[model samples]
Target: MWTINDFPAYGSLSGWSTKGYLACPNCNIDASSQSLRSKIGYMGARRYLPENHNWHRSKLFNGEIENRSKPVELSGEQILQQINLGTIDGKNKDTDKARLDLEDMQIRKELHLIRHANGSFQKPPALYTLSPAEQIGFYDFLQSVKYPDGYAANVSNCVTAKGGKLVGLKSHDCHLCSKTLRVTDLEKLQEQIILILCKLEKIFPPAFFDVMVHLAIHLPYEARLGGPVQYRWMYPIERMLSLLKGFVGNKARPEGSIAEAYISKECTSMNQLQNENSPKATDEMWSLANGPNALTNTCLGCICNGVQFHTIDRDNRRKCQNSGLVVKGDHEDQLIKFYGYLCKVWELTYLFGHRVVLFQCEWYNTGSSRTLRVEPHVTTVDIRSRWYKDDSFVFPSQVQHVFNVPDTKLRPNWRVVEKFQHRRIWDVPELDMPEFDEVLQDDENSTIVPTEPIDDVVVLRRDDIVPQIISMEVSQSNKRVQPEGVMDDAFICDDDDELTISGDDEEDEMENDFDTDTDLEF
Candidate 1:
């Protein structure tokens, strides 16, 4: 049960004895220290380093280099220095922090749930209720149980020192098939890991689920765990989910046609998961805990949105910089854009948790269900006995390339036009509907209320074209004014190289006079 807290610095597991040093397993020349990199579960080698330590070793073993000992060891300071040199991994540290923030929010929500298990209160629980050290201890215990390899939650090969001097390095024998994995076999292991994690992400929340599945995969056979059975069930489920969108949209199919195709695909992929590769205890547990539709139900809304409008293929390296759209900006088109972005976050969030909801409204049909989803209206989702507050999502930016809302000029859909019309009529009051304040319970949650009511009132005039401001300089480095069209002499471009000789004599005299004036002043 090693936790991140146990090691003040990044160190090896405590229960394990580092009593003996092993020979450089690859080199058989220099002695390998019993530190983090040389031991089992030390897969963070490529994280901050420019080259994989193993890559260097592989090259050496392949005779790319004669001496392996010449490989440089990156100091802690060097790693930080490299990070400052503009590695995106350094920014990933912030994303991890964001994840931790989300986790903290989840924990707070969980504590609230625990406190209100028998009550109706939705207030945040007090921090003093749980011991700080004890909470830390619980997190550590979870880390050890769920993620024994590292904080990254990556599956790793377990190795033991053969000779007292650390000569031999071999993997622990696979329980399913008494075969040992070398470093060469690690890629296969990583693929299996991706499949398992991706499957679990669809079923369970990423933060908790990844850790749980990792633990289940690694748990030994003698523990009498059902990890294998778990994985077996999920294999089909994952296959079904992967192909769900395709089946639904097939024109040659009926509604149930997709289901059969999904089932057939499931069996095929399942057989491959079990037969092609050996399933680990962690893989099994992950598969079992996440049942079919556990993923399907929670992710149904997100998948529906993704399948409907967004493209799964896009250049993901770019981030959307449309700060104009951040505060749910102007333009109905902007609202649609926001819809896509919100849904993308929801999909990502769903991969992270089960408590996701895609909010929608029946007000003024937009043909697209998500238009209803974006309305500041509530879409009640029943999570067992209790109702959880959920909102609709805008699709992710990566998917925006294809997921553009149908253009209104094509007379899009009457329903969409009607929704926009109703959205614009700001003053009209409706009695049967719940006010944003009442439904959101702004008094308790303190959620920000939009200045204008979203339902009957229109926010902007449809016929009025939004003026795109074009600024022009009033004078050199002074205030600017909006220019309607191209300036007559906007930029002066002279064909002939007319060198100005005006005031040359006076300029020379001025320069001499300035020099003389400076000398006199001195």
Candidate 2:
């Protein structure tokens, strides 16, 4: 399974057409489109915005006030209606018909062609088109971006800068990004997502949505329906297919070739896998997985909280840095973060086959204001400043990974400390231990029923929405550029700025929707 934006696969799987004005599978029937002078454009994104946004009143967007609430696309029964109405053909709609529709609506008047007395129309230069210099600069910016080591696995090869334009610019991390933004919270993700899409609509041209951008609206719903993304993502399945395809030595009979190779590999590994992982030998498997605690289980690398941490000695010859660390400690009875460079590691044996991983580190001075400073954005630590006198060790469970970036050429001793989090890694929750003492008593779940109703639970709404405003400096001579931060007053549109929706009611709904085993408020 892959993203719904993959039109053909999506259409075949869902049995809905991804064509014409209603290309978005989610917004099947109600998806709006505008006829540009050249091609059709998805231009009704303002409908997703809050009813009273300042953007609605501005002439910048379609030259009309957006008075519609967010469209809720329910199902795909509309596809049948479209077919019966003779509108499901795969060709793009007539631009002249679209122009007539726009003319009748009396919106986006600037897109109208200049008509002469001789019954001839003259085309005007599109305001959306970027100049050569601006296009080059944009391409350069993308090409010059420095992504993390593994975060952009195929993005580099996918993007290309040539002839003052970008080639093959497609969604490399749409699914990854969708999961990251909405997976954090599913219930309220819909509102935030609508805002984000509306923000994009404000920045990008109508044509920018040709890539089925509206499909993003349904990601939260899909995530709620499907428990985990791994079950639907194409990475594992595609990789397996690639491996099987690579086994094809005989092109004429590829099926047989793949089958032979698969059988041989499965034969070699299946016995070992089944023998080692048998459920009847659970104790033996656990003993092997964790290893014995009697003699020692010294290690060069340790996996704690999904992050694979290596000892300083193991990384002596490697270029990757994993020795930098941060741990919480008590300083003047205040919980403060302590930054350090890992020196050594120890696996201490304990009773009942238990072991503890300890990190011996050389810490930087965090007590003094000058030695370490937390800026508005990042934390800067002076490496020369010493804290080895205070503390030397931290438990693996308490340690968090941190990377030191050289602050500047001027301050050679100072370093900017950025915390490292395992992005793609997921830690599986430990299985519940069986109660051998008696029939397991189902104790009261605090999360299912809290001791007290949370009165101050934060309810996300359009009134409190804060969107990140970005400034795009385009080099154009005659074009009148729109001012940046146009959306700075998005929902603060009118005199009645007070929220119409009750915060308490919204909070109660959110709290009830949120189910957990612990008494944690999200």
Candidate 3:
């Protein structure tokens, strides 16, 4: 459907006006949204989930079980004829407004806002809010992230460049980039998507949802009918249009401008390379071109197989530890993979523009299972120990990129090896792929395949036998001590810094004085 575009463009293409809350094209007139004090929120994500799903029965989401059925699709004309209301009542959901709503409702008093003696109001951070320590850990994790060259956009830019505050990430950017492209199940995928969306509602706030988010409900169906999003998206046509638009110097005559630009760019260019059929240069001609000096360049970093790697010389400056590498080759009798740390990068320039790049590494012994252990689940190696000093260098093509995690702070010598496939590959899951016994032979005795009996899979959040209990104790200091006379709708803060619901003792005293005919001076 050529679907890739901005939110407004998405609505326009679907023949729907996206100005208001009823902007979800897939939901049609049945789209739901709660109008807040300033913005609209979509909190009814649980309605889309299957009724039998565990999330439907959980009270964690807004303290209620969702009984509402899936949204019913209706036409715009039918909706207008059915309701015809200029405005819908807004709901005070989450934050300070939520506390006020609960206060008025005389329920969930434990969640009421805490008023300090200094007249400042502060609500305890919600479950979704990360703790200060956890936030620091999250930032550290992102800061230390590394990816192969062309594997992904610079993730560090989203963290380190944001002045220590975590910000939203455009993972695939606003252009062409696919993170995951493989999908297997054609039947249960739609059902799975609904459950996932329902879970998101329990975690994120209502304001997170918009028309575009609701549009995801319809994607699986579209994909099933039309095909993958990669092929059907607008990139191809958009690129063509962009190229033509770049050529246009005159807006008044776009066709002629595009033609001129195409001719100038494609047919004739001063810097165009010579045709392959042109006569080859002699050795003397090559020497003249070289001018008696060899073209040589040195760099601290190098890119191989779309993965970025840095030499040990540059490792001190970088947060991403990209010096680790694993190379698999023949030993005395068997094939063994050696884990190592890259020490240097050598770029050797040769005659006629030929070049060679070698990675110098400090290898660790993989002669026995003590230095390297490959189990069914995890692969661990001791890269702290060094071996194979004589044959320490490897070509870029011979190495596989790997990141290591220490087994524990105390066991720094033992590292859990995490391997990455070649960049821009399929990344298919084993379970999803069809079984072919003849094509692929299973080796039960392999180090990767453990002979130990597998344990039963455990299901999460399935508390069938015991019911969980939650208790909250509101501090006496934060509690409102005085009686608030005749509570009204107004939650106004006066000059004295009080969130007054109604008139206080000072107002009553002033009224009494006025009734007694006492003269008042300013």
Candidate 4:
């Protein structure tokens, strides 16, 4: 029987009371009479004062030593104009206007500003505007302000604890409901509220103790009946109403328009679900150039051109079917050319369809060893091209790291040799190379290892090499594949060979790499 409409609104109790006092709902402080009035007057008066007036000083007029300043009273019309109380003609001086004028005069006298010799009153200053940082600093200062008996800290802690409980509930932590809404916490909250109200009575007005203030005391009971406050809160419902309001194209018949829009949306959604052939409903199939026997379905040997090759296992160890040779003698001569010597090779299928062979090559560097290190860098190459199998000795000039390597080599005429070296030949002792398969598995797991302290070279996977290409694509596609539901026999199976890599340890290794650059050989 109890509906939300039955309860008083949050701000219904706010505004100036019949006694001519303005109070805050949360602090229950009278803005017109007490410390709040002084603070407001002080801040407001500072805007109109000249820069040399020493605004930071506690008392501008040295009130303790000097005689008490005479209070300057203004007329009803002046008071109304000063407070923006609307235009009231001189002919109508009603009892209400007189009462308001008297109240305004009393507030002005309490503020205590100096009256000029000419008898003209100092105008109330504009509101103080603060930047984001200054606003935060001001809020912190207000929160830190102590109550008479040092109850401010206790009140602040209680409010903060209550807020944390509300946040937990909003995040769907239902288990915390019992602990947060315990009878002890509720009693403590009530006591704190009472103490705060008492302390603030001298400063705040009756309007400050609004319905919300009383609601805090009954929160525990409300939680008992409704569960979490978030579930019962109007914010989510209000947000949904705002969204529904956007669908109202016909203002004359808003309800009808909203209903029709809702129905159309539902119908469209239902059609999308039922229609499997719809482009939006289905995922794009991978477009392969070389039929089903593409590199994605088969091994790297399919495009090897009769050249023997090996696969890099999960542990990064080379598993050789024959001799672990990537290319034979003549075939190696055809693939290797002016770009560099192919030091290491890897076959990878990126995303859905992208399949290519990544060649790690060491380019000929003419510069002094100190100027630059001719490190083996990885780059993608199209397997379908005839240049990959032909004996033309024409290299793909679009190399990844060749442009980065300085061409300070003193001897340019030195012939670049072509040879079939094992994968270990390209492995640097100091560099802990990132696994390609693992990097693709989870982007968050990937760590950037700086090659050296001085050099800004970050050694990541080949897929993570090119900043323009890989950075966006890899991050968007890389998702951790959760294992499917375990079968009855899965529990009995052993996973001893599975490499358990921690993200923290990987980051630590990368950080350590930066410090141990001295041991690294060029």
- The predicted structure with the larger lDDT, 3 or 4, is 3
Clashes of each: 36, 0, 4, 8
C-alpha lDDT of candidate 1 relative to the true structure: 0.25
TM-scores for every predicted model: 0.17, 0.53, 0.53, 0.23
After superposition, candidate 2 runs with Cα above 4 Å error: 1-8, 37-40, 67-69, 76-87, 90-170, 174-184, 197-203, 238-300, 310-324, 341-356, 362-365, 371-386, 389-392, 402-522
Give stretches of model 1 more than 4 Å off: 1-20, 23-28, 34-299, 302-522
Instruction: Point out where model 3 deviates above 4 Å.
Output: 54-58, 71-112, 115-120, 160-164, 171-180, 185-193, 203-205, 208-325, 330-385, 393-522
lDDT per model vs. reference: 0.25, 0.51, 0.53, 0.29
Q: How big is the positional error of residue 520 in model 2, measured in Å on the Cα after superposition? A: 33
lDDT by residue (tens digit), candidate 4, 1-522: 012322324333222121212222221221212112111111122222233434323222211121222123345565456347521110111112222222333432332222445543332211122334444444443333222110011122211211111010111211122102334444444445433433332222222333323334344444444433433455457757977998999999999999999999999978765744434322334424333333433232211321222222210222112211122223234543233334444444443334355444333332233322334442222121123322222212232111111122333333212122111212223337644333212222222222321211222112212211111111112222112332233221111111111111111111110111111011
CA shift at 67, candidate 2, in angstroms?
4.2
Better of 1 and 2 by TM-score: 2
Encode model 2's per-residue lDDT on 1-522: one tens digit a residue: 245335557766665555554556666555665444334456666676677666666544555667766668554576566555753321122123333333444544544444556655543333333445555555544443333222333232323433332223344433332213233355466666666666555433444455355666776777665544554456656757978999999999999999999999989777755654534456555655765466654555656665556556654534345667788888889999888867766676544334557777888888887888786657899888776565697877788776666665327688788753344343433348733332211232111111232222222112222221213221222322222222222111111111111111111111111112111000
Residue-level lDDT tens digits of model 1 in 214-313: 3332333212222222222333455456557567765666567677877888899797656535445665455446632333322212222212211121
Which one wins on lDDT? 3
Query: Which residue pairs in candidate 4 collide?
Result: 29-204, 30-203, 30-204, 30-205, 366-408, 366-409, 367-408, 367-409
Q: Encode model 3's per-residue lDDT on 207-235: one tens digit a residue.
A: 44544456667666655554444544665
